[model samples]
Target: MNQGVQGPADTGVPAARGRPAAPPAPSRPDGGDAGPDTDRERAADPGTVRGEHTHSERPLPRPRPAVQRSSVRGQVLDALRTALVAGELAPGEVYSAPALGERFGVSATPVREAMQQLALEGAVEVVPNRGFRVVERDARELAELAEVRALIEVPVMLRLARTVPADRWRELRPLAEATVRAAASGCRAAYAESDRAFHRAVLAQGGNDQLVRIADDLHRRAQWPLVGGPARQRRAELVADAAEHTALLDALAARDLEVVRALVGEHFAGSV
Candidate 1:
């Protein structure tokens, strides 16, 4: 608040530790030095030489530059990934980069970058001389990812129930509520988004970043409505999924890993 009273030599500049602070440079013809040079220095003494300013005893943290907007290519890539998961880009289909670039209002460069990212993530396969092909999920890989998530995430939620601070529950309840509302409203996309939030909340224990990232890919895959019989084809069919989450929460509140594992396993299998 005080801006530190321009401490020490009191020139009002934040100084780096071993550098000699410079004296204020001569003002420009119109007025101030219309650039960053002025902000960087302040007079340690009224009439000192250019290099006479002393480094501040107390170091102030420098502010980082602001973030720039995402490039057009990045936006294109994001759009492609979304389209793929939404099933708009049908599984096992080949897409033309030029066509996609036109659809997304981008050049082939960004489209290509986005496709490469997807390919690396296993969402698409590279065909060497050919451009790229839509990724088709294998039943076995899908099952494996789902099962691994259940193994790790269910227990994490149980831990959350046991040890999560009372305040965190406040943050978590809303995601569950959102999941419920999305389901009731029959919005498949919203339901899936909220569903992912619920699992992330459960696994917030231990600040386990590595586990969280691995689980996200699997969660993203599960968000799409799986192709199946007529009963499962309705939008947001898993709206009632709250019951499954409640089951995990109950086991977590009870601090029961066995129940947690069983509940998570059932939920993962049920999604398929």
Candidate 2:
């Protein structure tokens, strides 16, 4: 007899020298094969275990926040305002949101949102079941806006002039200079924004938030192009208007209330 493990007598095949043979597959109730060992299969898969529920060891990525809609709406609002100031959006003309959206390469939703904001600003009005119509602001309305702004701003600016130091007014020189440059650029939208910035900076010295807000709103209304007026203002006209900002700053720095009142009055008069 051989001193090692024997082969099957019926098959007449010898066993391997060093390695053990794989175990036979288990039998099912119907005597069919039960396939590979589930424990060994689970061990091979990183996401699965022999006894516990399957899960990944690494964390799943977080979902990103939605920012495109609001951002697009803001962009559309700014563009619409600029178009209004630039006279691209004609007064009394109706514009559908879908048409504007097609031009802007976005959906109609953001355009409608922007148009609604414009409506609140008195720049446009809603047309029932149609679209938005640009408001045809008359010269008298523009003049009234300027008068209201002067009424609100002149007193606050004078009070600030009497109390605030020269250095504080000097600090606003850059803002005034910005208006001059924007005016020279001949972009009505640019000058409008810069002009408001200079005025807001001056009124902010009064430390009254409501005064600034009201004055700014009036200033914005006055900046819009009036009905039957030139589509774009002459560069020289814009430059002349911007120069008043620097002059106002000079008078404020000198604490000359008389000159401040005169300059403020003349500025409002020229606004029409």
Candidate 3:
């Protein structure tokens, strides 16, 4: 026993003298010694792992709400159509999807989709590898559209003038006033939409859905800017045109067929 057992001084260990021994240095997986600088680096880096079960201190990124693609496409389409009606998108000009998308603060995909819808409406045509070209429409084509509309709508309006009550026609006064306000704003697109609303209200009184649909389509075509036509229509002219809605409403309330026919004919003629 005396040969095998050693005293504290003979053992040569720090713990044997009642003092704690130094801990072993950490090592990397590759067996390299991890110094004080390595521990400091790991502590400084929020993304770095420390112990066996500890994770990074970095927070995850917040999730974003997704935007609806269809809503974006529809908005692009509406904006393009308004631009066309306002004559900002000139007839016979080619507009690339990338260029339009940049202008609208959107990606090219929605612009392309909107352009495709315009092509289907005959407002634009697809150009191979180029873009879409706005369809050039002449004064004659616009005149024809107006004439067809007059043919369909004048008779119905005249009929409504005879049968519809005065209160019903009075109810359309607000719609007519809306057109006036839109015209005063000097926005062609707004006036065009309000004008159509007034006409649609008038035609709705006739209770002919098919007739209204055809007339509405023709009215939209007639509103498009004509090639070689005035770049900007005079505000006075728009106001004058808008005033006719009120006059027609008055005539219908009074059941004055003669005045209604004259106003209706003159309105269509002025459209060309």
Best by lDDT: 3
lDDT of each: 0.66, 0.85, 0.86
Full ranking by TM-score? 2, 3, 1
**Higher-lDDT candidate among 1 and 2?**
2
- Please count the clashing residue pairs in each candidate, in the order shown: 0, 0, 0
Write one digit per residue (lDDT tens) for candidate 3, span 1-272. 35545442354543545665546666665556766587787677765553533322234576643367888999999899889998999999999999999999999999999999888778999999999999999977877887788889888999999999999999999999999999899888999999998999999998888888878878887888999777567888899999999999999999999999999999998963
Ranking by lDDT: 3, 2, 1
Model 3 weakest lDDT span, ten residues long: 50-59
Segments of candidate 3 deviating more than 4 angstroms: 1-67
Tell me the tens digit of each residue's lDDT in model 1 across 1-272. Answer: 45444543565557888986665555555565535554444443543345545332334577643332246766787677557645677766788787888898777777887898888777778777667887666567668777777777766766766786655555566677777776787645556667777877667655988888778777876644333323133554465465677666656666676887777787887664
* TM-score: model 3 vs. ground truth: 0.73
Model 2 lDDT tens row, 126-149: 999999999999978977877787
Task: Name the candidate that leads on TM-score.
Answer: 2
TM-score of each predicted structure versus truth:
0.64, 0.75, 0.73
